[model samples]
Target chain A: MTIVSTADLLAILPELLVMAGGCLVLVLDPLTAKDRKDWLAYFSLAVLGAAFVVGYWFMGALTGSPRPAFSGLYVLDAYGAFWKLLLILVSGLVILLAKAHLKLEEIDLPEFYAFILLSLSGMMVMVSGTDLLVIYLGLELMSLSLYVMAGFKRYAPRSLEAAAKYFILGSFSSGILLYGISLLFGRTGSTTLAGIRDGIAGLPPGDPILLMAMGLLVVGFGFKVAAVPFHMWTPDVYEGSPTSVTAYMAVASKAASFAAFLRVFLEALGGIKESWRMLLVAVCIATMVLGNVVAIVQTNIKRMLAYSSIAHAGYALIGLVVADAAGTASVMLYLAIYAFMNLGAFAVVTMLRRGGLEGDEIDDFTGLARRNKWAALVMLLFMFSLAGIPPTAGFIAKFYIFMAAVGANMTGLAVIAVVFAAISAYFYLRVVMVMYMKEPGETAGTPGYDVRVVASPAAIAVLLVAALGVLILGVFPDPLIQAAQSAILPLK
Target chain B: MVPIFFAYFALVSIVAGLLTVSLRNPVHCGIALLALLGHVAGLFVLLHAEFVAVVQIIIYAGAILILYLFVLMLLNLKTEERYFHRRHAWYITGVGALTVELLMVLLASRFSGAKGPATVAAVEEIGNSTAIGILMFSDYLLPFEIVGVFLLGAIVGAIVLAKTPSPADLSGDER
Candidate 1:
């Protein structure tokens, strides 16, 4: 075996930064006083910021060829770089959101910040890895942190339930994924993407064993991304976890999983596209129909968005179904837009927390326009974007994905997606309508007039960034689309 | 001699595995699990994977079995007469069908397909442990380090979940 070289170490510069910073913070957190826990948030943010900078630096360095490091276990390429930046950006905003949230909810723990950074590191690793083993390990690292973060409010029984449900289901999925990987390894005699590609090419088309492994892998990744038939845990987990954690799970975790998902399928298993594409098409249809149709009846805002995010995953799978470079690029672009819009919507959810109020029920949003116009307006923008309304980034994302699907002769799937997209607008716009048109009711002991939901400046700042990102990407999508296309260059 | 030992180990493992799952008493199930683990280790030893066999006995039969016993004892649960859950007939059937399907497919493929290439002789020349160590430290250094991060996350998660909540945490915002 070759020795670990300096170049290999340099190739994972962003991950190294995250590890060192996360560990340093984890070590220092206990030594610090309890009142000073807020400092951990800033320190974690600094770590994420540093990692983002390193990722951008690497992206600049990724001009000609993707760099294979640690004997092809990981590849530092533009595709990985794009997802790394997105994960880091989403995580940093989450930490910002968490700071106010922890304070508002009175669960001041320094370990929460450390978990975020650790999880963020895992996400970075997941995106960069090309080997199945490395990808699985990265996924575990990411998921373990999230499981803890979900139950960060340990005093709350609901939070504990969420964490328990997520842990049981998540570990089950990991087992399935590992079984698939082992089966693939058995068939191919390799775990690396390139090796798997060569192995698949050597075999006949749609070998039964290889197809079985591919199916298991799809199910595993589907669970991670909250695709249907595997998404039973999403609503409960999302509704019960701390809202900031829910946001991270909804966007950052989903994006990171997709990053590895695209790599493994499009790179390693691309030769067997016909074998896996049909399975994905069925899953995409089920996910869109179930997620959108179910979401319409949800009264709880978090549960509603949980289903909404599942629907969005279905739409994004449209891109994957196309199984081409443009399709992959569209998925990337859609996720970036999705990260902003979904995180922004969850940020508003986090803002609704006050003393003795959870603010998750859809009725909590009634007449929000009269009370907090700015928040209501931000909500409107995110809602419009999420529903694929014109002049919003969501629209452009859906358009690009649909166009890619059509270009690949998947117009039938695209039309079905558009119909589902239209169905999703009802639930998303209902939140808007409640905010603008409906009057606040006074039917309960808890007066609607005195529901003082306080949002910190930091929370408002996250919302502003998300709203601006969505609008900017919506209005001038050319640059981001081009970037997404460029990111797919190395993969092609 | 090897064939006879393999048959003995396989029979013991199969019986123990069945008992582990089918036993009504929790304590009996735990004991059965220990036997199953030990017999599985013997099978691994028969396959020349001595390192895995030893680790299996030490980890599964030794530590994990003890943990299971502790949970079982602490719970002191009665025997569950209903072998299957009442509300989960469909779930059980579906899972059973899928398992049977997977078993059939795997078995069919195993018998029909050509065997994989033999392990590199270099691995046998060196100890399997040494070979694995070298590859893990060198070729898979990145994943090794990432596992460290995963462990760290797990440690924090355990602490966060099990730690007692203070009065200050339950109260409203202090910021």
Candidate 2:
């Protein structure tokens, strides 16, 4: 008898394509001529496009019921498909963003493309995994690639420092996660979601072992999503890494982690909602309050966005606290919109490079409006969107999340989130204020500073796609909302 | 007799673990690690997980410990002047308290989880390695395959981060 059937192969076709593409890129990296290394990025884009097409094609089969594959270790469903499509889209945009930024940073190794593809495959596996072991392995694959990419500029001390800190902390978090899995396995005798649910069905609500395992899992996932107390490495790593890698980490990695986070919590642990909901509320409030409050004091733009991403993770956690179908759908909508606006913001940051100086500080935007009006305009759009201003996607993402909270009788949590949202607006708008209000060469630290925007075609394309996505989703969100609604059915 | 063996392995493993961390000399630390791994493997064997026990000895004790020794010898590492600082007193206290609390909780809680099919009799019937092989290839095929990609990524990352930079790469940096 065959161990894996044709259906199993078909279920993982997209992931296989991405993995093969990554290997192909790695194999061709040294063979490709130096001047033609750009072809690798294009090839990786093609690979992602192919995977997207395949994944989208499979969405039809995944709409109603979840299909278990590989002896139920993996599942094919609209929830996974939705996140996979979003991840593919984000990775594609990141590749477009990276192409020009890598050249500007003088770290244009073709292995960068390979790592992106490999990490994308890991994310695909993560979203689809039905077993905790599979998810952990996928997380490792994704993180190892990112750890390397974060220090792609190997000679830079800050880059090396970022890589070392991230690797060490990330491994510690993974160990914690594995320990949680082991505890869970000891309590339930299984690692699969279905098995664990069944195993814990008869357990008391406050069973010490079960609660401990759940708490550890929350801490593990909290670290991955960079929620508040576990968020110490975010600002440093984001500030030190290349802009493109930071963008990928902030958008794609966060989205994938949130996807897995939602799956494991809602599907496996949904039975004990009351027990976990209070714990999540505490974490959610702390994350939002600390992330938004601390962000107001950051001098570097990357550090500000890192905190902003942390705050966004908190907003998404509100959905987990609500613990309903609406809550899950709201998180999907929020992350999808978040990917657009955050990437748009980072694309602009990536383009602010000129000569040897990395213009990553808030002061770099002192006179950006005068230097490049169009660039300043897009940055304005992204900043407004991130700040949740009306007529932008961020507002809509927050609206759905808070609406879900209120629907679930979490009005108090919703109110607290709205207040933090209001507070977060101050820092986001500061970039806009500096860009439009300040005069060229007005800052005292440097004289005759020419803030040129390196607007390549690829970067412009990414900006356009992201800007259009943010605007279109804000105005006409019916399709995505409906998609998210259907996507949560299996979990319910 | 079984309880006696268990006590000996557990005690020695804990002591070696502490020594691995607290030892001043790197080589001595490596040796402590080897003892710790061996005792851990012995404990695994006592639990009837012979496959894991043997693999642990082969991988951790044989391969990984050798690697640690090679790296220590290559660096020609010296004994540290000071292992602990006065400032770390609070940290040590905090960690010790947490460990004690955890131990208290573990000892108090009763673990009555659902039992698996891998009893000693069944393991003896099917053999440990064969049972593991069947499970790995059948039930855990997907995770097993993903581990391949995971290790491949690790290798690529190790090479990318550690390999000497090419002339062209250095020139690009200067430019």
Candidate 3:
């Protein structure tokens, strides 16, 4: 008998395409000349575009029921499709952003493109995984690529330090996650979500072993998503890595981790919602409080964005705590909007490099409006969206999340989140203030005086797409809302 | 005979594990780890998981331990006079107490999970290696394939980080 049928292969066509594309890039990296390396970035983008098209096509072909493949180790459904599409889009934008940034930083290597494709494939696998083991493997694949990419700048000591710290802490968390999976396997006799649910249904409420496993799982996922208490690595890693990588890690990795986190909890542990609900509520509150309060003190733009990303994770966790269809759909919408705005913000940061100077500090934005009106304008849009201001996608994202929380009778949590959201706006708006209000300082023999906003054609293209996405989504969110609503139908 | 073998393997492995961590000399630590791995493999063999036992010896004891030794030697790391500080007594005590508490809790609880289909009789009938091969090829195929991509990523990442750039590349105006 055949082990993998044709249907199974067809089911994973997008993943296959990405893996093939990654391998092709690796093979072609050394064969191609040095100056033509930019082609590799474009090639990787084409591959991501192809995978997105394929995934979207399959999404259209999705039936009412989720289709299981590989003995139910993986599944193809609208939820997975939605996440895959978002991840692909984020990865593509990151590549465009990276093309110029890498050249500017002098760390342009074709392997960078290969790692992106490989990691994107890992995230695709992660979102579609139906089994805990499959999810763990996918998580590892994604993280391993990121760990390497984090230290891509070998010449920079901070970059190396970031990679080492991320690698050590990330591996420790993965070990904890694997230990939890093993404990869960021992308790339930199965690693698949359906089997785990069935097994859990037969167990007594609050079984100590199962509770321990659940808590461990939460800790593991908390680290990956950069939730508070597990967010120590976020600032250092984000500030130290290449800006393009920071953007990708901040958006795509968090999105994929949340997708897997929701699936594992809602599908496998949905039987014991009361037990995990309070646990996540506490975590959510702590994450928001710490992420926002600490972000106010950050001077570096990357570090501030890192804390903002942490706060965003907390906001998303509110949906997980609600544990309903509306909660899930709100999270999907929030992350999609977050992707556009966050990537736009990082894309601007990526282009802020002048000769021999890294313009990553908030002071770099002093009189940015005077220097480049368009850059400042796009940055303002992103900051406004990030702060959840009106007529911005960020506002809509937060509104949905709070609405979902309130609908589930979680008014207390919603109120707490709104307070934190209001607190977060101060820092996001601070960027705009620095740009439009402050005068550019002229220093003797420092590149600070001539802080030129260097925008390559590729970077400009990214800015346009991201800005358009933020504006369009902010104004007309009906289509995405409907899509997110339909996407969560499988979970119910 | 079986109980005697099990006791010997389990006891030795636990002692070796402690030694691996406590030994000051790096080489001695490596040796202790090797002994720990060998004893764990012995325990696995006693459980009739011969395939896993062999793999444990080959992969962990043979490959990984050797790589550790190579790195240790290449780095020429000097053994420090003091590995732990006396001022950290309270910290150590807290950790030890927590570990003891965890052990007590684990020893008190009974494992009440349902058993799987892969009983001893089933494994013996199918043969351990063949059973594992079947599972890897069929039910675990997707994970198996994903591992390939994972390793490729790791290999490429290692190369990208470790590869020394030539002078011409480093002298570019981009830097």
In terms of lDDT, which candidate is strongest? 3
lDDT of 1 by residue, A1-492 (tens): 678899988998888888888888889988889778888888888988888998999887885569998988999898899999999999899989989987777676888888888888888888888899999999999999999998888878888899999999999999999999988888888888998888888887757799899999999999999998999999999998989999999999999998888888999998998879999999999999999999999999999999999999999999888988889999999999999999999999888843376688887888888888998999999999999998999999999999999999989999999999998999999999998997665556432444556879889899999999999999999988987888884543
Worst 10 residues of 3 chain A by lDDT: A441-450
- lDDT for each residue of candidate 3 in A68-105, tens digit (9 for 90 to 100): 99988999999999999999999998998899998888
Better by lDDT, candidate 2 or 1: 2
Candidate 2 stretches greater than 4 Å from native: A442-444, B79-83, B171-175
Model 3, stretches more than 4 Å misplaced?
A: A445-448, B1-15, B79-81, B172-175
- By DockQ, the best candidate is 2
Candidates 1 and 3 compared: the better one by DockQ is: 3
Worst 10 residues of 1 chain A by lDDT: A443-452
DockQ of each: 0.53, 0.58, 0.56
**Residue-wise lDDT of candidate 3 within B57-103, one digit each (tens)?**
99999999999999998888795634777866887689789878877
Better of 1 and 3 by TM-score: 3
Local distance difference test, per candidate?
0.87, 0.90, 0.91
User: For residues B41-151, what per-residue lDDT tens digits would candidate 1 score against the true structure?
Assistant: 999888677788899999988898898888777776765434766766687689779978977876666433333333646657888788778878888787888887788
Tens-place lDDT digits, model 2, residues B64-92: 99999998888886754246777778887
The CAPRI classification for model 2 reads as medium
lDDT of 3 at A37: 89
Each prediction's Cα RMSD?
Answer: 2.5, 1.8, 1.9
Q: Say which prediction, candidate 1 or candidate 2, comes out ahead on TM-score.
A: 2
